[model samples]
Target: MLQSDRAEAAEAAAVIETQCPFCSVQCKMTVTEGGKGIPGQRRAEYKVEGVPNAASEGRVCVKGMHAHQHAVHSQRLTHPFIRSNGELVPCSWDEAFAVARQHLQGISEQHGPDANAVYGGGSLTNETAYLLGKFARVALGTRYIDYNGRFCMSAAASAGSKTFGIDRGLTFRLADIPLARCIVLAGTNIAECQPTLLPYFNQAKENGAKIIVIDPRKTATAAMADMHLPIRPGTDTILADAMLKIIMDEGFIDETFIQARTNGYDELSVYLNSLDLSQAADICGLELEQIREAALAYGEADTGMVLTARGVEQQTDGHLAVRHFLNLVLATGKIGREGCGYGAITGQGNGQGGREHGQKADQLPGYRSIESEKDRAYVASVWGVEAATLPGKGVSAYEMMELIHQGVIKSLFVMGSNPIVSNPNAGLVEEGLNKLDFLMVADMFMSETARMADLVLPVTSYMENEGTLTNLEGRVLLREAGRQAPGEARHDWMILCSMADMLGKGHYFRFHEPEEIFNELRLASKGGIADYYGISYDRLRREKGVYWPCPSPEEAGVGLLFQQSFAHPDGKALFSIMEGDPWKGVSEEYPLILTNGRVLSHYLTGVQTRRSPSLLARELENFVEIHPITAQRYRIRDGEWVEAQSEHGCFTVRARIKDQIREDTLFVPMHWGGVQNVNHATRPDLDPFCKMPGFKTSAVRIRPLHQKVYRENDSYTER
Candidate 1:
């Protein structure tokens, strides 16, 4: 049980009570109370601990363990702040809201409604995201808003939409992974990103599943795989296409399922006629033998699933790549079956929930399209807003930033995103932020992007708020308020309501509690394709978190979807033809390719985990991971201070040599910021389909720094 009062704790104890809401593993904890454990208080468990719940399983990583400390860190914004003389100063909420109204209204008054852009993060609660979407379309009178999910799961969702006529993934649950006999993973790093699911992978291994890993990096998960294919970056679609060709040529496809359930087979067949195994193998940097081996292994397995992550979906050709991957699953009749399907592992904890609840610019709740008349009318009827007034689609995250830099977007209201630290092409986002006539940011901490804001509003941490969060597997769980909010910090939803009220659009946000907002979203979802018509707050609370498609009282909602028929108009899964392409940044001048990712110790941007004493004490500072050969070539020593510079920008940090990385590429964790922000030197190029910047690849040079290395004395060399 948590203490009733936070006031009695020491300064250090109060700092670690916040929750880390970034990834699918929502870690719950209590901060250490008061002073760094005095002699009398040494026995107290001041460190944040994981809640013993079904969702968390009484386990947590470094990021989740120290999440609470971030809320009270030095960078936390305690009050409403307004920019004065190019400096941010603490101000009253009234003053902040006044500035907001003035700037936003002025932008609309002068340049028209289209000039304002609203950007939300996937990290936001379902309630906050839902209201933000409403505000963008109704109050702001603009359709230009998209969350970071655009960069994370758009391609996968779009691929599912094309195949199923609906944009959801598994009808199956995360628990089903352990039951699989074959798990075909393409371009995803699930083992590192979603550590909680690792045991399931091991379970599959124990069940005699042949795990096939296709990726550029030989990750820990890949190393554990029965087979790992080190394909060239950006060439995933090619491999997928080759597998389809083999499946069709060998007659492994379910002809009955194809004829009875799908559309567009002739077009796909004609498209695949041109590519050969040798061509695909050559382009993808894999041998034909390896491809054939992987294909046969996957096809022969009793049960299988093709799981992907940001790696396959973060490239310019991401959509096409996913489409091809889905093609293989459809051709083999692997989908809609137990322990076999096409699934994308979401990075953020609530990304699935946020998107389902209508955080996207082009979508309404229940995965309904905003552009469709029926959907718009049905949702409008439920939301009690005029269907005609609800605007159409808007630009995505990368596009918005481009528009901002191009001067098409003059003002931006950012919620729960640290684009300055998280987005690729950090320089471009910085330029865009500096150019904004008015920038409003709502967050608990004054993050890198928030620092550039014209107005910053202090918001409550997850532990201080009440709402529901849906995990990657579509399990919606309640978030109970366990601690008191600091200073004037308030819930993010409340702040939006106050802003809406000031703007004379209070009706758009009539709810007083997040639960009320969720009820309205559910109402808006009625009669839609991704319908949760039978779902209510009551059902959710009663069952932990129910999966979507919960439209019947008897339906527990299948975890592995598409077991009977696909959501396609023809009720069948369709295949797409794809070809391989090399990484866009491959060049002679910048010989080595660089990639970015996260470690078990940190989450995105390091804004939260870095602030926690428990987690930070584990890692002193930011460092780059590189292959020993590459490091030696640059005259770099292990644990040596160095500067990594790219064409876009540069940063200095210590380098750690590890053989896990490929000699031709370098790996950097995405969690670092301040003096060692990785995005500073990252390029702005985005995947053509999803518009997600190529965070995995960059061209960079490394040189040893004469300065002292931070971890020179640490004994990381031994276990």
Candidate 2:
């Protein structure tokens, strides 16, 4: 309001361009680095505004605008900590590194190299993920390396690889949303989980695109759809199969595309002909007419798209569900055309790129399978190591926890992940962590998992560090930082390099910056499926972002995949037949289906999001969402405490009785921790194909708080 105030504000302002760290949309924005805090908000600093980007066209959500507050929170870890007699205390970095080296080497020497393990997270940068995988293989000489992405994206990744021979989150760009004539969403709450993406869907609807939604809960996304099929949990494949059969019976099949561009259709057609629409409808708790309408709408469209998320992927038969959906797109000639394709919306900000570089137990950089001798040799050459020295595939994420409980894995090095709140059946994960001979965690704050660690290393958050992230569209963008990390907090790669030096592998891990590590990544990824040999930091800055498979400088990047042919050697996509009973396995003793998901207020595990004062004020804690009929059956009142018990564990929380969810199902948010953490009651039954845990369809029973059993039995099965 005054001239002096305007002069002082202009004197201290410096702008920087960056992106959000919450989800896969990766909305870009500009921040005033030295600006004052919001006019009315406390502890929230820096002024933010959305900038135009391909993924998010000049729009930012509440999480993106205030994401920087957590980076400057007072509770951040400023110094490395080493556990004393019974508690963790601040210590010097050298002392902490020395203790870590001593214990890691001792464990490896006594029980062999397989005893040492490394666990990473999906939000880690490409360079950090690549180096972490190398540290596990060369520095610790261990094979136990995996990440949290296995819990979030592995099911869709497996199915995409099996069908299309490549696994990118989206085959095309986000700008093509308005060009589609029909769209189908299965088991995903896009409105709450990815609010910034709602604009594109809104534009599509305005442009005359028919939308179909399949979910047990009448989510906000479902409310906006033209048709909502209130299907039962764990029965997605049955509904998908029924649609496939309807498309065929109604003569919507593209004969030319089936003959020229696909395989195994004869077998798929045989099964589709045998599928009964009425029987499938009864099994899935849906009317036959809803299924027929959705199928015919998609079949008659000139250009169509199908997208899915954890609702279909966090099941025991998750891979089968993705396969069936991809089959629907391919059989009707919906793919490889402008505005027609299939994509799985990635939950984490870097889930797409994290899996491409490494950090998975069975994969190498560039999406190469570590099991292949040639692939191993090529990557080994890039690392200046012999192929024979590399370790083979170890195990999946949840299985690694099982090994920890079995005592096969004596020590673990965790980075950027909090399995205590993110993993399924987290009670068992906590018990296994307690059994570790030595446990180390690197995080920006004292996460739930960090509280149980023998050593805790301070690391920088994305808002305080510079790196690269591949968003859901497979666009590799150079992310910038607006402020320096507080205290002695350092980058994860820097901490890892120090550890590698202490382990006597300094030559291979000699890198002072992210670009040096990224250069090495380019060489290792040269000929692999996710080739990035030609992409450089300078190129990223000039072009904004480049898609993967940019094998040469002149080629730039390829956003549209398979315009001519599929990535398979034969240049054709493949379809597989699925046969089995589609059931959530609910019994009379545990007759209700429990589903886990995210809310609009918080993110996965709530490590950083909860620290933000404004984000926490909206949803202070988690609650059990129950239908009116189910609440009446259990004699539970609104706002009354209720206990939900499963074979895995039990959690008691306040009940919010509503009619939005199905009568046979219960919905719980996945952002909280402690006694009310929903993961405590989620099943860990993994899919046979991708090993993704069944977080969607757990058999559970509920009762009023006072009427609960006095003695709760604990059944910890290593599933």
Candidate 3:
């Protein structure tokens, strides 16, 4: 029996402690199964309340309170389905498996293994994410496997690896934020997405810490800052380099830390000598004095903190943006001590762990490059396969859609992602899906992407499964299964294992439970950067949670990293020279910059949150947030329909004019999908190094449509 089932059978406790299934905060909460009709059968009576755990500290957001709807939503997939004559109909599991295997094998034999691929979600647990990679490489023999996290955390991961030899999001704990003398929040909206973490920043402010926020708009988080640097979109690197120059000119450079712990300072200094703040001020749309004051406050602080998110990491030079920000943290010696660190605010629940364990296209079991022969051999030995047989590195997430459009990839298996709504350039994704010879999806609901799949397999949710997840702080957490999967829904392990058996790869996938898969994963990840051999379900429960790089069971998880030496063999961090690049996304026809982000009431793609009446009542549709001056230029009015047109495509949404944003910029929520999708107006251009799409930067022009176009019973995802 499952652990939760065993506990309930014994009546040990009425409420079970579990982690929230939404954002990376992973707030710990208690769930009780009571006042239900056969608890977990037809309906689940889950009462969720926050606990005083490490991440949230007894604070629950609206999403966590309503997360109980995932199991009992009206449109949840209750059985396996297959496309019959252009219509999806209910089918038996055996028929679904037979169809999936026949198409996958036929596609491989006809075109090659590269023609088949796997696209996964960052919300999956570490165990499920690991097995998804293995299933692609071993069962299907495909090299093109990547997850949706490429759109969120790839740039930050690349920058962290290049600078410090490892990427673990936060090097320290969230609890340490209160001790910092200064904190810089760049391109992250903490007040809306991670409301639970605001307490830490609030405590830092209460302790007399100065907070500086950088973004194009004066967001709610920015409104409370000591200084707000309202910058132009795609100018993150420009501002960071300017700050480094100011810190050096003001005599705040830590020469001792530079000489002892890092390299490449002289080259950076030489590059800084050529900086022009006057021109930078014009490009960044900020007053020169605001920039200087913000830099001085942080440089003069005894200790500093820097936290970056999607705003800076979604541009064409995203990797360089993150690297430039790291320059400030390293040059000021603001790391490896109390109240001093750098981290990326991961957006998804398992975004950190998902990228660490083989979900990335070019990564192995433990964040090791697939092109490295040593890494290949070590991982092959763990999987009981020959190193020569393993596939090499593949393309990234957005490039997979390009491959499908180019006819190089014909079949795809997506697990728990709604790319039709989530991926940028919606037209390109829709076209690629139309060209696919076979497409299968595993999800609990018919998401926008699942609606186009050739086969849809019913899968379980976090409330119905038990596995471990790593949060943004590198802490590995255990999430307990609080209820059973209703109807014919099954765990991802069971579905994958049965499919492997049908494909004649049963020997490699003989796992009966999630723990068995995690055990094997622990062995595979023994020597890699994210070394998780020390993490186990038992240890997780005992310690509450533990950070990664725990190489042995006798050793505790290392929450504090880089005390003396960096992860490199030479015991020194590498400082990348900041590059000055130009962003010419705006043209005469499209005179304004466009940015899309999440709203306070809804989650990604609105696949799960849209199902809840409470969340929908709070936010029924995405709106176009524009500056009043920008709105007046186009003669647009607030609460009216407006068409935002770009070179890619266009969409009409309600216009909401406000003075909180730049006059030359526009903002839109990225939750709604289908015809109301905002991603249709964004470019699919990728950062050359990290392969991250420019989801936050686009060029567009807005015009009021002068009418509201809607039907009484309009549908989007189900359509």
Candidate 4:
């Protein structure tokens, strides 16, 4: 039985403990049921309380405190909907499934199985993600299966895999944060984005740890740092190279550790010799002394760590930029030890587990490549299918959308993600969606993307589901279903099962519970990098969480990876060679550099958070931040309406004048959609290695809006 089912079967406990479904921190929370007669019925009213766990210690964010509000909101989708004559009307489950199956089969018969694709979300539990990938490949017989996580941390994953031969979010635990003598936070405003993690940094600060924040603006996180390197947009690679050059100049290289722990030092040293600190400083628009001081502080520390976020990972050179940061850690030999390692802060709830368990287009479960014949044979055996029946690798998420725009992918199945608001080039994505022959979305609410679908399937929220999620620290925690799904809404796993049955693949997808699927996952990942063979739901209950690579039942999971040697075949970490050329520069027509980020009150795309009254009250609309000098140059005042135009598109938002950002840069939140969508102005240029979009930096021009367009109370008329 599932852990949630087991928990519900217990009659004594009124409050059930589960992990929060927002962000990668996975903060533990207890749901107190009120006036409960039966476990799943009796008009379940709920409240959230913080529970101590490996990721968070009894601390919940404002969003977590109110996450339950949207689950039972009046506007939540309770039944399936089918579009007829340009209007969405409630329909029966059988009719909706029939329509979906008909279109899926028709599309495949007409244009082959390659014409159909599946796009999923990072918020899905490991079991659902694994089954979704299986459904797409086996039931639909389609090769195109990818998730929204490609945009979140793929660059870091690609870099980490190439450098260390394995890609887990963090090599060490969160408890090690306070033990590090120095930490460099690159492109992450953890104070607002992941507030539950702020206490760790606070503890680190209390212990005299030096915090160096690298960002383009003086965010809430940067304000608390010992030193903030306000870098120019898209110059992360240049800044990283300059820091390495400075470290070498100060003779801070650990020769003994280098000889004992890593490889490729000679090649990296030759490349570092070609880089000039002054040139990099000029390119990054930062002072040489600032770079030197930051490098000295990090290099001089006995044990230090580097953490990258969406800022560095959303660039055209994202993979290379991440590799540059890894090079710094390798040079200082501060890895594979307590309080020292390189990590990428995963943004979504199950971004880590979702990617590890076969959601990506190019990977199988256990972080194995789909292209490997051995991996295919092993996974095929586990699924009771012939190895040759598996389809070939498909494109990334953005590439899949492009194919849809070109009429290659005739049908699409979207689950848990609202790509119309979240994907890069939002206007183009919507246009592509309109061109699809058939589009279906499964979500808890009628999201912006769901409104565009031909058929919309109502699915239960995280509170009404049971599964496991891997946090940013690689710890796997259980998420229990606290209440019954309202109305006709079903769990995503059940929905997938029903769809598989309708497609005549019920024999392969015959699991009746989530635990059944999870057991299969354990077998599939027995000998892989993200091995979860030893972890069972019962074990997870006894221990709050367990890290991966627990190969045997008697062996406890390892909190710190690569303690003795790196995962590479040679047992040595590799350093990346830095690139000298700067990223694409700004053109005269679009002189200012425009960047985007998230807000504390609003999660990605604002599909769920915006529906909550509390979160909406905190941040109702989007605004762009411009330096005082830039605002003055554009003849725009604070709260004045302005149009930011890039080569891709233009968006209008209120201007907030501040000197925190660079004079030539502007900042906008990535939450609002439609006319307020910042992604409309973002370029779709992707990293060559990981296919991550360059959402962090785009060249644009700012012009004050017409007087009539500006409204009172610091708001602008929506276009």
Error of 4 at 297 (Å): 0.2
Cα lDDT tens digits for candidate 4, 1-719: 56666555455346766777789999999877653444455565567899877778899999898787787688889999999999999999999999988999899999999999999999999999999999998899899999999999999999999999999899889999999999999999999989999989889989889999999999999999999999987889889888988898889989888899888888888988888778889889999999999999999999999999999999989999999999899999888899899889999999999999887999888887899999999999998999899998999998888898899999999999988888887778889999999999999888889999999999988788999999998998888887788999989989899999999888899988889999999998888889999999999888978999888778899889888988898998888874734576598899989999989998888888988888899988999999988888878999878889898898889888999999989999998887888988888888889999999889999888764355578777643
lDDT of 2 at 429: 91
Residue pairs in candidate 4 whose N, alpha carbon or C atoms collide under 3 angstroms: none
What TM-score, computed on C-alpha atoms, does each candidate reach?
0.90, 0.97, 0.95, 0.95
Q: What is every candidate's alpha-carbon RMSD to the true fold?
A: 5.4, 3.0, 4.4, 4.7
Q: Is candidate 1 or candidate 4 better by TM-score?
A: 4
Candidate 1 regions with alpha-carbon error over 4 angstroms: 1-20, 27-44, 47-58, 72-75, 248-251, 552-555, 578-580, 643-646, 701-719
Q: lDDT tens digits, residues 299-379, model 3?
A: 999988999999999888999999999999999999999899898999999999999889789999888879999998988
Error of 2 at 640 (Å): 1.8
| Model 1 lDDT tens row, 99-147 | 8999888899999888998888777887788888888887888889888
- Cα lDDT of model 2 overall? 0.90
Better of 1 and 3 by lDDT: 3
- Model 3 TM-score, 2 decimals: 0.95
Cα-based lDDT for every prediction = 0.76, 0.90, 0.89, 0.89
Q: Candidate 1 clash total?
A: 27
Sorted by TM-score, highest first, which candidate order results? 2, 3, 4, 1
Model 2: colliding residue pairs: none
